[model samples]
Target chain A: MKIDKSLLTGSTTMLILKLLEQSDMYGYQMIEELEKRSQNVFTLKAGTLYPILHTLEQEGRIESYTKEIPSKRPRKYYMITKNGRKLLDEKKAEWQFYATAVNQVLGGEGYVGV
Target chain B: MSECNLLVKEFLNITCEEIKAKRVHKQIVNELSDHIEEQTQYYIKQGFDELTATKKALEQMGNPTIVGKELNKAHQPKTEWSIIVLTFTLVIIGGFIQYFVSRANSYNSHAFFRFLIYAPIGLIAFFCAYFFDYTIIKIYSKLLYSALFISTIIGFVFINRINGTYLYVYYSAILFIPIFAGIVYSLREKGYFGIILCGILYGGVAILCLFSVRTIAFLLLSISCLAILTFAINKGYFKCNKRIGLSIIYTPIFLILILSVYYILSAGHRRERFATMFNPENDPMGAGYLSLLIRELVGNSQPFGLSQLKGSLANMKAELILPAYNTDFILTFVFARFGYIFGVIIIALFIVFLARIFTSVLKQKNKFGVLISFSACLAITIQFALYTLSNLGIIATFSVTLPFISYGGLGFITNMLLIGIVLSVYRNSNIIMESL
Candidate 1:
């Protein structure tokens, strides 16, 4: 099933937090990682990804700094805070609960049981 | 390759049209451009030609406007409405404090009405400052500072003079020393020249104050501005060493020492206030009289006692215990009439107001905005602290207003104007902070 834009909107920060909860990453990295890991199911525009990252940075759930590497210009990297970890854990449970409920509703109970 | 660069520029430029604070939008532009270039390079490594790689990169990033709008949502200049609301609320409270005190003394109620009349004017000043693009101040900060400084001198030299020597003006006028300092520093950039220029503007004003409006309150204010300049320089205002900045930053401190020494040796009304401050009881029937009155009223009032307001009111009306009950000593008026509970509330509000200005300064990426907002905050903080100290008999009663709450046209109006500047800075604080 195709995911709704509204659903994507709601989960954008949670997904970013979840990604950052594992490793520090830059904007393009996060975009590529999310798309790759989600089996090409997620394809967020840079425009969509960055504002969420910036907002999360301001919310103190994530913070950013630039690091220099050999043979490249410095790039901005983001890391999740403890608060972001807490939020990610909560979002994980919420998604689990939500998906299970949807499965139950869409499963055998919805057709003629009522 | 050059054509490819143009495409990236066009893309990034379109991304920042909605964002104000050019520097902030520039950072976003450059940052996003970095990502685009990286992606284009990735495409090139995948066997695409340069032109195709660039085209593909642009296509993948999506429309610049949509991305720009999304980014703009986070970077929009924010106004501190909580501070604005708190300021208006306190101004109303001040009006009530004045109204009730007037009524308490003479059984007349128009002072509050007068304040009500004044409220709209103050609110207009506040909003005008809030909405006025603060960046415009940079273009004419020199002219603005000179005008304020020259006008002060002209006001002192030609407009008002007591006994052709002792300097005095409306209490509100004195508050401008610190504000003018803010304006002075707002025009500064990162260098020794800016520091020297600040010293000139501040020193000229300080000297002008010395020969004319010789108020100790302003001396403290000038010193506070120096402290603000020091802070601005430390926080990337100048390229000077942070430790060395402290030593060189004594421009105001040095001015204060010279002026104090001059004031002491010159022998006039200035000497008496210092002597009186350190020892309030030295001359109970003379210079220390008002300070002593504030002390007894505040020191003796019941904490959280409503009845005490009436008692102070009756005492004020029945006997000439404290004069200027409506103006310089308005804090005492509120404390005496409304008791300590209301008094603490007023102090808390002032602290909150200054905090609002301070927080706004911290968020600013524009150096001018940060310095300007910071100086305004420091000046007002000093005024509020000194007023409270004087009211509690902890410091010399310099007769400064309690900012928006004080009963006077110029001080009240000027206070509103500074708040407007703070609001304007807050409104335009989204300067791209790549370095800061």
Candidate 2:
């Protein structure tokens, strides 16, 4: 329930990369899908989302293009690059270790069984 | 149906390319058309109208700029370089004026010495203004104020040591200090308090130190009037019609009070000077002498002017009329030799020069531009007015010169620096416009 916003920045990038690994998506669709898949637990404002997208594009971790959709407005779609995939893999392993460590501490019943 | 399609087409045409305009257009058209058709069918099934539902659907789409913002997001950003260049150019002109005039007026010194003293100071002031981020200046407004305060104190203290009663002290402290403070305050991000304080401090010093109650009274009155105007603007008191009427009434009454005081404190010789102002026959051998001589020079001239340095009135040895002809009454001397037409031309040029500064200020967008433009304009204008009044024998003779045209080193340098600030404001205006 408690989340450090600064820590969430890296997590956000990891989430973006993993989502792009599945399929190319624009900013609005990515935000909508993230909220839906997480059961509405996560949401990103446009200001934060656009700046991250720009940073990722500048770093060549992702590429974007204008995509036209039938019966809907066209969107700026971003896809993960090879570098982004490698980065996502590294981040996933790190998150797994961090989650296990946190779970172990919370699950402890006694202090060294003294 | 045709009218609806035409509206959709016009909406699509107005949309920018940035926001996937064509795609959004297609989607809106399809969704709206489908909804309208469905609603119309539902209404028909209920035994109602078809056109009403379609009209209702179209009405809900709202204003276009809301949609246009989406398209604008993709547009490339560009910086306004013209404004930056213009601001930079004006600041440089100010520096050059200071340097060139100082060099021209330096007496018994080599040109190299003049350049050595003036060049580096001028360049540093110009470049600092050009390269320094204006935002940074704004953020550190307090530091700028303290620095200006210190410089004013220094200038005020040292001014008394310089030669010439009217030339060194009043010109430096009275005119220059407040103007410099205005420029500095304008450049910084702070409100007008620093400039207002500067004006008060300078005016205060002139009152306390100058030993002339008449001069002090007038200077204080001027500062107070300007301060009140500035305060009214800041407080938004000018918004009310009643406040405007009050200000109109208050100003002339204050001016009359200052004039009455000036007359009361004026010495016998000073009174004689005023008498001569109205009638040249009051005492031609004494107080009326300068006025009568000036009248002769102005009245005798043709269109172009008398030959340079050739008037009988100016050449004291040739006429045996007045003593100390070259210095305190220099304008009269210049007019006598050069003629009234030439005097008129010089005054016109000064007016044109000040007008140019006013024009530049009017064109500027920021508060800094407004304050600096007005302060510099007032400073130059007042000094020129004083010089003209003294020359025409309308006021007690004082030795202030017409800026740039006059032959004084310190006054000339100070004038150049003032011009530089005007240029700085002009340049700033250009930059702001370009950014827009």
Candidate 3:
């Protein structure tokens, strides 16, 4: 299914934070991994991924470090902080609540007895 | 193994062109270039030729202008509005205080008007310092330090004192302290030798002030400079043993403090002033006069409205007036004329102002920015503390002007310049790299 870009915009931060929550990652790695996990349904552009990562780092939610491997160009890696983890959990809860509410309104299987 | 292709280079250029902080352009370009290369490799392995794969990779990266605009938004220089607002509020309040001072002293009748003139000039100075990059101090630290040193010697040879106080030299010392932070930063790579070099620079200030016979300036300059050096050492910027660095930094301060105590004890007049500082009532007619007057004024002060003077204070009020009421003693004047509440509010305002400046210091990512902002903070903080103490008669009276509140042109302009440099440091905080 092709998701509208606008639909994914608001969730990009949460998705990026979710990826970092798994392990430290570089920009390309995060994009490739996100796409692979989504079965290639979500191909995050490099332009979109970096700005979110840089903004998160600025807010102290995550931090970046340069790791130089032998005979390879040094890569800038970002890891989630305690604050980033907390944010991710809240984002997860919020996303779940939001998805459940939308499904209920649409009269889907997510409907519950209120 | 190969050079970057022209198409990739052109795309990188367009992306980085949108980033206002040129300092971070290289890093961002490198990161983005790496992304494109990785994407290209993936495509090449999937059965595409190199040029076609690179083009495909670029297509996936999205438009350069949009990416660059977003990155620029992230790296934009942070202007600290809170500090700016607090500073101007204090400056306007200072204008009111100067007006009160003008009403009390005939010789200072023009003081308020002078401040009115200096205000716009101060604003210009503030913006000039704010917009200008302060890292240039790192490039010319040695030359600037030597220039200040030589100028101080020359100042001693010509204009030494105004009304028997070393005001000119003292204000110059206040201006030099912030610049000294840059010198300390420039020497960070020298290790222990850097500590020694800083010590020598500080020693030179002490010796210059000693020979020039300006003890107060020497005290203010040496103490504030030492604080910056100690801060740098503790932050491990000196790249030397912390304990050894601290010991090296403090040994001279300790020796100087002891020498000052001895010097004061050996002089009868200085000893009398020092002794009367403890008990102003003992010498109410002489050395304790100002202290006693300050205490009487503060003691009679009401909370909300103006306090009515009584007893000795009332009698003295009719016959004698406070000297420097417009300059150093403005805080006491505020308490005497307005209320303790007014004085407390002013002090609280200063506390907020200092807090704002300190917050900027914490936000700084670059070492040079940290040191510059911190040194400015230290200088202003010392002045504010000493001026308040002196005004309240808790310490012997000296010629220290309260930062942004005192009635002096040079002190006002110098303080604005310092705050400007701090704001400038904050403006470039995110853009500058951490390494240099």
Candidate 4:
């Protein structure tokens, strides 16, 4: 199966942004949520996921806070920034357009040459 | 719930402080434990026994260190400003000790003159290093290489017009120019192979231009370059066989060049100095005088030494010794005057001085910082060691000057430039910290 290395990161970022849009979560919860939401179709490796969180934090697209949970360790929880919400909306629109264009071709219809 | 969880939690707590990020540790522990628990629960739900499920979950967790390290890499905090300030303070203190205290007792007009001439050169080298962006230096490696080549050639051609010995005049810049350029280019280029090539080329030319006047200085310079080359190779910046082959090729070529130059510049007294070094009795009053005096001072100071400036050996009543007491063999002079206690103190100070520089180098996180700082430290430390060893008769007298303490323009300026390079590394480390 061919994989676009470039798309992997952007998709992971969008997935993270979308997930955090629901509620703030730590790294493990984020990974679990992504897996559960996608029915294991997207297994976000810890290595790939943390850098995206850090990059988002650095970009001010997300903000993180730490809270101690009883019977478990303290976790750094990431929440989407206003800027992050804005970016997520724009990315959703762009991805919708891209998915439709690709699906049109994959759906067995010949390209209406433009 | 799993064996791996217990082991990983223990390991993570123990190593977390070393990870450089407080936030990362919390994130990693939480994430890893949750994942392990989830895996164990998943396996148990699939009808495995509890222990068996835990074993499977633990196995599927992969290496905790690999996972922990990836997390650490992603969120490692920029080095704190306190660390940078502490490093800079230590380096400046080291430089001050080397300059002032190390050479205090040996004050003289010649020493002052040497300082005056070389200090400006050192300051220029320092500023050049201080203000120049290391990235720009690396990006224009070829340009720096060409500049070094052209300058060396220009100095060589103009050697005859200079006041000093032809060789000394021609190659004085060899000490700092190539080293500075090498470091800058290496840092910018992401490897020191280019710097090593430039060093070898410059060193090869120095050997070609060698004469009796600066043979020892040239040898010391070449050895310093080789030390840096060795360090670069050890750090994996250059491939092993390539570096080894280059050294092997350079050595024989250097020897041949030196032999030819020696033949051209060989004067009666210069040849006699070489002969007398082997057997000082051959011309005790002539070329052998300095070596004999050095041996006598060091020998007399054994177990413990005579009082400072009090050794009759250094006084040399009616004996032919070098006219100046401290120019070349200041170590011996210091030992004779201050006794073995002072000698040990001086050696200890030099070791401490080198140790501090090395500490700063090791603390640096970036590759360029490590290489440049380490190279400069190695150069100074080896020179100091060789000078001390030769003075104590542990090696042949190579006419090497004690760094910073020695009274020579070239030696002094080169020493300052080295100090400057180290400081530049510290400064850049601060900038990196601030950026983070």
- The prediction achieving the highest lDDT against the true structure is 3
**Per-candidate interface DockQ score:** 0.41, 0.01, 0.58, 0.09
Q: What lDDT does candidate 4 reach at residue B197? A: 54
Q: Please, what's the RMSD in Å of model 1? A: 6.0
Pairs that collide, model 2: B83-B430, B83-B431, B86-B427, B87-B427, B94-B420, B138-B189
Tally clashes: model 3: 0
How would you encode candidate 3's per-residue C-alpha lDDT over A19-90 as one tens digit per residue?
998899999999999999999878889999998888888777888888996887899999998989999999
Q: Tell me the interface RMSD of every candidate, in Å.
A: 2.1, 11.7, 2.4, 5.5
Report per-candidate TM-score of chain A alone: 0.86, 0.82, 0.91, 0.85
Candidate 3 C-alpha lDDT tens digits along B1-436: 3343988999999999999888899899889988998999999999998989999999999999999999998898887899999998899899988886677667778988899999888889899999887888888988888888888778766875665555577767887887789889999967889999988887787777666566667778877898899889989998889999899877876897899899999999888878887888879898788888787777777785555677655634411467777777888878877779999999999998899899888877678889999998888888898889888878777777787888888888889999999899888877775632
Candidate 4: which stretches are off by over 4 Å?
A: A1-114, B1-137, B140-142, B145-149, B152-164, B167-200, B207-213, B233-275, B302-322, B363-365, B396-399, B408-410, B426-436
lDDT of 4 by residue, B1-436 (tens): 5665666566456545445555345555565566666767878899998778766765655454565555455554333344334434433433443344235434342445445566567557656755455444445545665565566557657657343455453234335433443553354333445555556665554654464256655665566556655555555554345556456546765888899668855888667665666777787777566567677776666445353224554444211343444545667655665566767777876776777778877756455666666666766776788778767655556555565666555665666666666666665552332110
Candidate 4 reaches a DockQ of 0.09
Candidate 1 CAPRI assessment class: acceptable
Root-mean-square deviation of Cα positions for candidate 2 versus the true structure, in angstroms:
23.7
TM (B chain), model 1: 0.80
| Weakest lDDT window of 10 consecutive positions for candidate 3 chain A | A105-114
Ranking by TM-score: 3, 1, 4, 2
lDDT of 1 by residue, B59-162 (tens): 98989888888777877666577987888788778777777666675543566767777778877877787777665565666776667666766665567466
Over B1-436, each residue of candidate 2 has an lDDT whose tens digit, in order, gives: 5765565455434543334423234433343344334444545677655555444433433334444453334322223344334433433433443344334344422434454555456555544544343333334544554564465457556656434232344443434433443444443333344434434544554543354223522453365336434543454433434454345445655886799769855778677656665776877777566666665654555455352334553433211343343334545644554466656766666666666766765654445445555566566667778877767666555456455444444555565555555566554442322110
